[model samples]
Target: MSFDSFLSQIKSKASELKTDVLKFKNKDFLNAAMAGSALIAMADGSVSAEEKQKMLKFIEGNEALSVFSTSDVIKAFSDFIGQLEFDKDIGEAKAYQALGKMKNNVEAARLLIRMIIAIAAADGSFDVTEKKVAQKIAQELGLNPADFEL
Candidate 1:
């Protein structure tokens, strides 16, 4: 397909996906995932290209979230990072709330929590700020601290 056609196709798919995500009642899970991913990307005060790639890869590969289109995944990450750029506390609060929404599905919740921990540890070492954020995320998931020990 021509580049224009490709772009058009993507836009159409994105619109459809947007509707799907909007219909999702689990805004908290989406928000939490977005917030955690953003925090992981921005833990060092800036988001790196490599970190962004890792987050995209993880979200794309996640089975539980297979319903999310690549564009939606990208959109959520972008939303999270953009929020962080404006205010850290607000971003963290959003992520914390998102995590809180995924408490019922134990496995899904744990998977997200584990992914958040992994993302935080991706850039070599998990800093105090990252750990604290991860802990908060874990609490939102209603998981034990021992599960993702500092």
Candidate 2:
């Protein structure tokens, strides 16, 4: 499917799973989601303007995370990016640690993976770096990369 249609389907599916999404709206979930987004976005060393914009739009529009204020979401994403900019190895370790929090929650982990993939593909090119990062995320989540066709 096209990116727009894929995104639309994700949103619709999220709405259908509102209860599950709501339960995952806690600080840990937000942190993991933001960290995952940052990791995928920075897989190639930098995030494109379009990728950033599309990610923000997806976060804002996603029904599951709509409970958060726009500023809060922005802050979460920025905080992760700031850490990465400061130190690559350390920052990635920290980010992956955050993502590791969702490892036990299969549902949340899957959703997080999908969201990160969407962000990586937002620029219309899911490159090798992004795919590798995503594969690592899948392993961290106790999932298989093949499930996402990575």
Best by lDDT: 2
List ranges where model 2 is wrong by over 4 Å.
1-11, 17-19, 48-54
lDDT per residue as tens, model 2, 1-150: 999999999777767655566778888888998899899878879767786787788777766667677788889998888899889889899999999999999999988888788767766899898899999999999999999998
Which of the numbered candidates is closest to the native, going by highest TM-score?
A: 2
What's the residue-level lDDT of 112 in candidate 2? 84
RMSD of 1: 9.9
TM-score of 1: 0.64
State the TM-score for model 2.
0.82
Off by over 4 Å in 1: 1-28, 61-67, 123-128
Error of 1 at 111 (Å): 1.8
Instruction: Give TM-scores for every candidate, taking all chains together and pairing residue i with residue i.
Output: 0.64, 0.82
In Å, residue 4's CA in model 1 sits off its true spot by: 43
